[model samples]
Target: MIQEKRSKRGALLGLAASILVLVLVIVLENTLAPTSQLFVVLKKGAVYSLVAVSMNLVNGFTGLFSLGQAGFMLLGAYTYAILTVPVSAKDTVYYLFGGSAVKFSLPDLFGGVDTPTGLILGVLLAIILGGCVAAFFAWLIGLPVLRLKSDYLAIATLGFAEIIRAIFQWQALGPITNGANMITQIPTFNNFNITDESGKVVFRLSAFFPMLIMIICVALIVMLINSSYGRAFKAIREDEIAAEAMGINLAKHKMLSFVISSFFSGVGGALFAMFANNAQAKVYTSTMTYEILLIVVIGGIGSISGSVLSTFLYVACSEWWLRGLDMGSFLGIKLGLFRNGFRMVVFSVVIMIVVLFFRQGIMGNKEITDLLKPRKKTKEVAK
Candidate 1:
C-alpha cells in the first residue's frame, strides 16, 4: 500500500512538473521571444500539434483506423468561418443561398450584440456545437463500422470522408457551407478587437492565448488516458477478444473513443479555420486525411508525446523549409526540375521508408518518459 501511494505521488509530481515547464516555456516565448525564430516555429507548429494529439487519441490509443479526420476538420472549419466572419463582407455574399440578401445579425440574448464579446462568444459556441454534432456522427458511424477489421475499417472511413466531401460539394447546403465558391474577407481572430488607429489593443488574440488553450486540452486528454477508462482502451488495443473476455464493454469503449476523437478534431478544425482567416469550404480530399495519418504513423502510433514532437517537425518542414527550398542551389548544380509538388513526393517517400524499415515509427509505442528510466548504480566506487 505504501509503495502504491508513493507511485501515485510520484506520478502527480511528474505531471505537475511537466505542466510548470510547459507554462514557463509558453511565457518565455510570448514575453521575451515573441519575434524569435523559435516562436515562429511554435506558432506554425500549433495547428499540426492539435491534429496529431487528437489523432493519437483515436488511432494510437483506441486502435481505430479512421481516415475521416479531414472531413470532421472541414466541418468545424466551415462552421467557425460562418459564425465568426462579419456578415457584411463581400465574401459573405458568396456564402448566401436562395437569392436573398443575408444580413448580419447576432442574437439579442448575447449582450451588446455589436461588440467583440458577442462575436467571440458566438465563434466559441459554434466550435463547441459543431464539435458535438460531429461527435454524434462519429458515434453513429462507429457503431456499425467499428465491427470490421483493419483494412475494412480504413476503407469504410475513407468512404465516409468522400461522402462528406460530396455533401459539401452539393449545392443543397449552400446557405450554410457556401458550396465550392471560396469564402473570403474573413476577419482574423487577432484582428477582432476594438483597436485605436495606432493599434494599441483593446483586445487581441495573443500568441500565448491559443497555446494556453491547447495546453488545457492536452492536460485533459492526458488525465483521461491515465484513468481506468484509458486502461480499458489499452486492453482493447492489445487484444479485443481478451478485453471482451475481461467483461469490458467493447462497443461502449469504441464509441466513446470515436466520439472523443471527433470532438477534439472539431476543436482543432475550428482553430485552423480561425487561424486561416475563415477560408471558404472546399471538397475535403484524401490528401488532408492522409497527411494527418502520416503524421501519426511517423510519430509512432499510440504515443502522444511522439505525435506532438513529430507534428512540430512535420509542420516546420512543410511551412518553412519545404516552401523555401531552392532547387537550383543543390550541390553547385541547378536542379530546377523539382516543382511545387516536390515536398509532397519527398514526404510520401519518407513515409514509405519509415513503414518499411522502422515499422514501429519514431518512439515505437513508448512515450518520452519511457525512454528515461533511472540508471542503476554500481558498487565499484566503494573499492
Candidate 2:
C-alpha cells in the first residue's frame, strides 16, 4: 500500500512539473521571445496539436486506423472561412462569382459595436459552426465505414477524403467554395483592435492564450481517457472480440469516439483558418493527413501527452530553428541550403530514426504517470 501511495504521489508530481514547464514556455514566449517568430511557431503547433490529439483518440485509444482527418479539417476550414469573411471584403476581385454566395452581416442588436468585437464574434461563430458540421459528417460516415477494419478502413477513409476534395473542386460548388480559385481578404486575428493610438487594446494572438486553450482541450481529453470510459476504449483497442464478450457495446463506443474526435478536429481547423487568415481547399490534401498521422505515430500511439509534447518540439525544430536559419551567415560559412526543403528532409529522417530505434515512440504505451514512479527501495531487516 505504501508503494502504491508513493506511485500515485510521483504521478501527481510529474503532472505538476509538466504543467509548470508549459506555463513557463508560454510566459517566455509572451514576454521575451520575438513576437512574429513566436506567434508563427505557437500558432502552427497549436493547430497540429489538435490534429494529433484527435487522431490519437481514434487510432491510439480506440484502435482505429483513420486517415481522413485532413478531409474533416478541410471541411471545417472552409465552413469557418465562408461564414466569417466580411461582406465588403467579399465584393473584391477575389470573390468573383458573388451571387448569394456570402452571408450578409447582421446588424448589431445590442447598441453600437466595434471592429474587434465583430471579429471575435465571427471567430467564435466559425468554431461552433465548424464543430457542428464536422460532427454531422462523422455520424454520416461512421454508420457505414465504421463497419470495416485495418487496411479496408484506411482505404475507405482515404477515399472519403478524396471525395470531399473532389466535391470542393467541382465547379457546381463554386458558388460556395470559389472552387480552385483561392479565397482571400480573410482578416487576420491581429487585425482587430480598439487602440487609442497607445496600442493598449492590441488583442494580439498572445502565445499564452492559444496555448492555454490547447492545453485545456488536451487536459479534458486526458481526463476522459483516464476515466472508466477510457479504460473501455483501451479494452476495445486491445481486443474488440473479448471487449464485446464482456458486455461492452463496440459500435456505440466507436461512434462516440469518432464524433468527439471529429468535433475537436473541426475546432482545430477553424483555429487554423483564423490564424492563416485564408482558407484554401487545395491545401487540404492526402499529404496533410499523412503528416498528422506521422506526428501521432512518432509521438506514441494512444498517448495524449506524447502528442502535445511532440507537436511543440516538432514545430519548434522545423519552423523556428531549421527553416528560419540564416544559412548565408551560419558560422560565417556559405551553407545556404539549410533554409528550404532541408528542414523537411531532416525532420523526415528524424522520424525514420525514431521509428527504427523506438518503434513504440517516446511514451510507448505508457502515460506520463508511468515514467515518474519512485524506485522501490529494498527493505533490510536486522543483519
Candidate 3:
C-alpha cells in the first residue's frame, strides 16, 4: 500500500509538471515571432520524439532488433497523403496520372473542408488510419520476420523497408502514389492556427498541435509499458528461453510489440509529412532508419525519457543551434574549420564521445518520473 501511494503521488506530480510545461509552451508560442527558430526546432523535435520513442518501444523495451521503421513510416506517410489530399486539388497533384485514383478526401467525407470541425476530424482520423495501415503491414511482416533473431532480423526489416520504398515509386501506382513524384498540398501543422475573417492570424497553436499529439501518444505507450504485457516483453528481451520457460507466449507478445511500435511510427511518419509539407517515397530510405537508430542509441535503448530529451537536443543542435557553424562561425567565433557541413562533423564527434563514455545512455532503463521521485530520508541518531 505504501509503495502504491508513492507511485500515485509520483504520477500526479508528473502530470502536473507536464501541464505546466505545456502552458508555458503556449505562452511562448504567442509571444515569439512566427519565424522564430524555436518553432522550427519544436515542430521537428516533436515529430522525431514520437518516432524515436516508437523505435525504442521495440528495440529497447522488447529487445527486438528490427529495422523496418522507415518502411512502416513510409506506409503511414503515403496513407495519410493519399487520404487527406483535398478533392479539388487531387487533379493538380496527380495531373500526370490524369487525377488521383481515390474519389474523396477524409475531410470532405466527414464534413465540409471549410469547417474547422471537419478539418480536425479528418486530419486526426487520417493520421490514425495511417497508423492502422502501418500496423497491419507490421502484423503481416512480423509473422515471418519475427522468427529471425538479432542482425538477421534487422537485415530482413531493412530489406522490407527498401522494397516498400521501391514499390511506392513504380509508374503503375502513379495514380495512387504519384509514382516517384512528391505528394504535396497536405494540411500541415500551421493549418491548426486560428485566423480571422480578414485572413490574419489570431492564435498560434501550430507548435501545440504536434506537442499535444506527442504527449498523448507517449503517455499511452508509457501506460502500456507499465502493464503486465510490458513486463512480458521485458522478460522476452532479457531471455527468450527463460520467458518461454515461465509460460509466457513469446510469439504473441513479440507480435504485439512490433505492431504497437509500427503503429506509432506510422503516426510519426504522418506527422513528418505534415512537418515537411510533402511526402516522397525517396524520403523514407535506409538512411532515415539509420538516423532513427542513431537517436535510439544516443538516447539509450530502453529509456523513453532519454529518447524525448535527446531528440530535442539533436534537432536543436543539427537544425538550429549549430547552423552558424555552416556559415563559418558559431557563437561569434569564426574558425577556418567552420564551414558548410562542419556542424554535422562536430555533432558526430560529440555523439561518439557520449557513446564511448556513457554506454547505457542518459537514463538507461529509467523514466523521467524516476528522477522526479524524492530521495528517501534516513533517520539520524543524536546523543
lDDT against the true structure, each candidate: 0.67, 0.72, 0.88
State the weakest 10-residue window (summed lDDT) of model 3.
374-383
Per-candidate TM equals 0.82, 0.85, 0.96
TM-score rank, highest first? 3, 2, 1
Error of 3 at 317 (Å): 0.8
Which lDDT value does model 1 have at 106? 33
* Model 2 lDDT per residue over 1-383, tens place: 97567555744654566467566655565466345566677778888898789889989999988888988887888787777656666666245576437655321211112454565666666677887788789889999999899789888988888898888777777777877766665644444433566657433334554555566667667767767788888899999999999989999998888888888788777767767767787888899888888888888998776787677778778777665443433345556575656667778898999888888887777666555435633121100
Residue runs of model 3 more than 4 Å from their true location after superposition: 375-383
List model 3 lDDT by residue over 182-217, tens digit each: 989988898888888887889999898988888888
Clashing pairs in 3: none
Scored by Cα lDDT, where does model 1 land? 0.67
Clashes of 3: 0
TM-score, prediction 3: 0.96
Find the candidate with the highest lDDT and give its number. 3
Better of 1 and 3 by lDDT: 3
